[model samples]
Target: MAENLPAGWSINGNGAEKSWFRRFEFPEYARLRRFLDGLAELAEATGVHPDNIGFGKDYANVSLTVPSSEEEQARLGDFVSRLDRLFEEN
Candidate 1:
């Protein structure tokens, strides 16, 4: 799971509860809102939603579960990469 995580993301917990987490910060609320909206759209399009998403006016904390299967791990890696792209685009 550590190998699959993108830069700026960290792993938490152990066993089945293990997850990848990242906190994104924005300069302003509007930018944060746009990022959150894009995240929602990405989740819908990819069907790889985060396990938990918590946000304030200028930051968002995203957590995605670590799947046990190798196939799922690959998908998660792809998803995490796309998420990084989305953040850059926003």
Candidate 2:
């Protein structure tokens, strides 16, 4: 999972579910929340959304998934590039 992360991001194992991982932490929680909300909406509009999106912590954890593997890879590329910019701003 860490290898699949965008540049400048890293992941660690959490005590709970094996899927639990942390990415870039934002200085402003509200801004990050807003960003996550918009990202979710975008995914919905695209018709291929993530399976899970857990927030409230300093970081946003998004589990990307799609019924089709090809579409998932394409969306992942776009999502990764967008996420890298947020990390860059911090």
Candidate 3:
């Protein structure tokens, strides 16, 4: 099943070669940490892993760079949507 993304999620950075960025605010760092591992797993399961994650005390800075290939872009979109929904549940 495809996950739903939250409103106002925007694309940042320039060019497909550069990493993509999204900012999300969660309840707390502990909860965020717990969920991120699961989220990373999902990314791997789908074969579209995030490049790096910056965890703040209460927020997350996610950066992903899927290849320009159509399949990778699709998978990347799916990953971001899932993350958007996961945030809602937490």
Candidate 4:
């Protein structure tokens, strides 16, 4: 499934782990904050939140997982696609 993820995203752990994660880097704190704020708004509107969102002055880490069911996998894939587009646009 990791092979199906968008560029810059990858599996967080080895075999049996279902989570995917990506770390986004910014040149400064201001840009990082703005990016996170936009991501938060998207998450709220979509109701598909990351399992974890961590950030420092220059980077943000977003992680997510879908349950084992096929429907959940589809939903997660859509959310991930949205996230990738948001990152690119921002």
Off by over 4 Å in 4: 1-3, 14-17
Clashing pairs in 4: none
lDDT of 2 by residue, 4-52 (tens): 5555534344433323133556678877876776666666666546557
Q: Give the runs in model 2 whose Cα sits over 4 Å from its true position.
A: 1-5, 8-22, 66-68, 86-90
Q: What is the TM-score of each candidate against the true structure?
A: 0.93, 0.55, 0.75, 0.82
Writing each residue's lDDT as its tens digit, candidate 1 over 1-90 gives: 346457899999989998999999999999899888888998898889999999988899999999899988888888888888989988
Residue pairs with colliding backbones in model 1 are none
lDDT of 4 by residue, 1-90 (tens): 435777788887655566889999988788788889888887898787998999988999998874677777787788888777877776
lDDT per residue as tens, model 3, 1-90 = 222333645555656555667777777777787678778788778877777887877777888864677676677778877887777776
Q: How far out, in Å, is residue 86 in model 4?
A: 1.5
Overall lDDT per candidate, in order of appearance: 0.89, 0.56, 0.71, 0.81
Sorting all predicted structures by lDDT, with the top scorer first, yields: 1, 4, 3, 2
Candidate 1: C-alpha lDDT: 0.89
Candidate 2 has an lDDT of 0.56
